[model samples]
Target: MAPFPYLAWVAASTVLVPFASRSETAKLARADVPRSRAREKLGFATGQRDATQPLVWFHAASVGESLSVLALITRIGAALPDTQFLITSGTATSADLIARRMPPRCQHQFAPLDAPGPLRRFLKHWCPDAAIFVESELWPQMLRRTHASGARMALVNARLSTDSVKRWQQMPATARYMLDVFDLILTQNDAMAETIVSLGAPPARVARGINLKSMADPLPVDHAALAEAQTALRNRPVWIASSTHQGEEQSVLKAHQRLLRRWPDLCLILAPRHPARGQEVADLITEAGMSHSRRSAGDAPAGQVFLADTLGELGTWYALSDIVFLGGSLRPIGGHNPFEVAHSGATVLSGTHVTNFAETFSGMEELGAARFVSDAADLAEKVEALFSDTQGREMACAAALEFAQQQTDKLDEIAARLITTLELSA
Candidate 1:
């Protein structure tokens, strides 16, 4: 790894992190309500660890990465009787979700802020035997501190988007130093492996692993809630515009407006990529001159655009939708997990930015089991087309189910490798 830029970038990030921590403290007061107890929100009980224990640490960024870690942790614990894992994430939402799902022996925490002092304090206290980082969480201080504590590190199920690679290239030295810190860089596909090597992850350490993201169990949704939602909107042709970013919603709303003129009873559910933006979405709907109601608000009318401003229920929306237009792509954020929506047996529509989940969506498209919309208008057209063609819709759904059946093996392969690498069976 080269020097100057890498040093500066780390120095700058090290400086900025404290400010970022301040912002987290600020956000907690505004939303989480109990501002003072934010640090205790890490999810682990407050106290020193018992001296006699085997410990490994896993760090993830947010809900998606953390949930994937949970899948791996389950495998680790069933095999290793003595090992206890320390899991950490950055957000309260992630902390709460992990509070619900982490393994019996594992503990979750807010992963103290990524500055030298806090990370050093955390490393000294935890003294993990091995450290694992889930996709895209390349915090320098955490990596450096973990390595210094004599814990070997691995970047598992790694990914590099085309855009990210370009940015990293401009600061080759910093990218390389960060890349080299990992003892191994396991990728989900050859392209990612190639990109990792190009970014200076040791070529020998880079290998293809199953994308843990691809392996997630279709999220569990509440059957009672599904039945209730179905009853609430009886026989309406429902489609979801999921994980919608900013500009995409306007197009989706326009398309929704157009579709209503024809289908008249068409129901649309817009689940924004960020729940905090729910009010903004409601405003956008009102701006479009459409009646709307938020799930957060009361008395949802049958004829309004429903803003599903909640977390984790996205699966339920997909399960209920006749079609799903995955949001990020139609605008520009490169797309989200179309596989999740596809697994729900909903016809899937995506825009071009699926660089993140490249291989997964490609397989779905290869099966002719999902559609790639040119944009929001294309999403509307495809949904309208599928609605008029029940036979075609059923065919796509069946193929999607078949495509999903093939992914079960991939999950097992990843979980097995993670268990072996962590030496959990000992």
Candidate 2:
């Protein structure tokens, strides 16, 4: 018999499925996402699965989570040539990006809504031999149905916060019921492994693993575009404030202003976290009285500040500078990934609030590959010091590069573990 809490959730979700489907379809349409893709959320699986071959399904919640597993999938595919892959994510953005970077023998799908009908139809079509859920994607119905189908299951790179652990403690039976679906639970660190075991995951099945995001392929770079932007900059000293958030840009702009005092020709590339806010960020730049050019407007990096308000071009910007200030840390938003920056041969300067990547940042700081800044003044001061000290900057960059390179072997170990644990060898 199902636990009372699980049964209650099932009843409520079944009743709400229709309304939820309609609401999601309407929202996706409003966002200009294709109707075909939106219908996927309602359990309309597209494309035919190859039944003769083993299919491994991977589910991730959004962009970062979705991208983090590509390299792993590729490695597994190389080892098991007959294994096909199905990757599902819940956002249009993730779908679009995955489509561009999908590994061979892999198909991308929008994950079905976590209700009976959608999961039923989705499972019937795909019939994946094994399923892996990335990070914190814990859909109860999805797990229950997938497990009942007899597919081996694993939860990779699992992590949870203090609040989530407490919440799960309150519903011990429900937590155990859902988590028991996984044959293995590989956590991001020892702490998370402890947390999951405490939350009722079988201690024998839980183990520590590296953060998958840290091992994802470096962001794709466009060399032609990089060349064009470099020509436009005319050899000016360059720095980037990439992935800045809403309240964080004011500080970045002020820091840029301070930077200009020492190096008048220094170029600042301001890439916001959301490119949809291009015009809004442009307004901020204009109001700040800095000369700026907009990337979406087809403007080159000619102005003192270049508003890099587009998608998937971060690698190009990173290629142009060795100094990078990754945002989201300045105001407690939990810092963005510094691994990508480090992989691009840049030394990282970030704010102190990097809880999301606390382990990664701490390791980098200890190795002298990254630094933490308090605010605009501190950010400016650090940037100036790096700019003046060529040897120091190069040493930091080398350390960061080494840190990134060290993860390659770890990824191989992780891939081997997943293949063996999931019995995915073809």
Best-matching candidate per lDDT: 2
The TM-scores, one per candidate, come to 0.85, 0.98
lDDT by residue (tens digit), candidate 1, 200-258: 77888788886776666676687876777888889788878889898888989988998
What lDDT is reached at residue 132 by model 2?
96
lDDT of 2: 0.91
Task: List the candidate 1 regions with Cα displacement exceeding 4 Å.
Answer: 1-23, 33-37, 40-53, 78-82, 100-104, 160-181, 299-301
Write the residue-wise lDDT of candidate 2 on 1-426 in tens digits: 778988888889899999999898887787788898888897898777988999999999989899999988988888899999999998878888898788999998889999889999999999999999999999899999999999999999898778878888999999999899998999998989998998899999999988888887787898999889989998999999998999989999999999898899999999999999888899999999999999998888978899999888999999999999999999989888999999999999999999888889988999899999999999999999999999999999999999999888899998888889988766
In model 1, what lDDT does residue 88 have? 81
lDDT scores of the candidates, listed in order: 0.76, 0.91
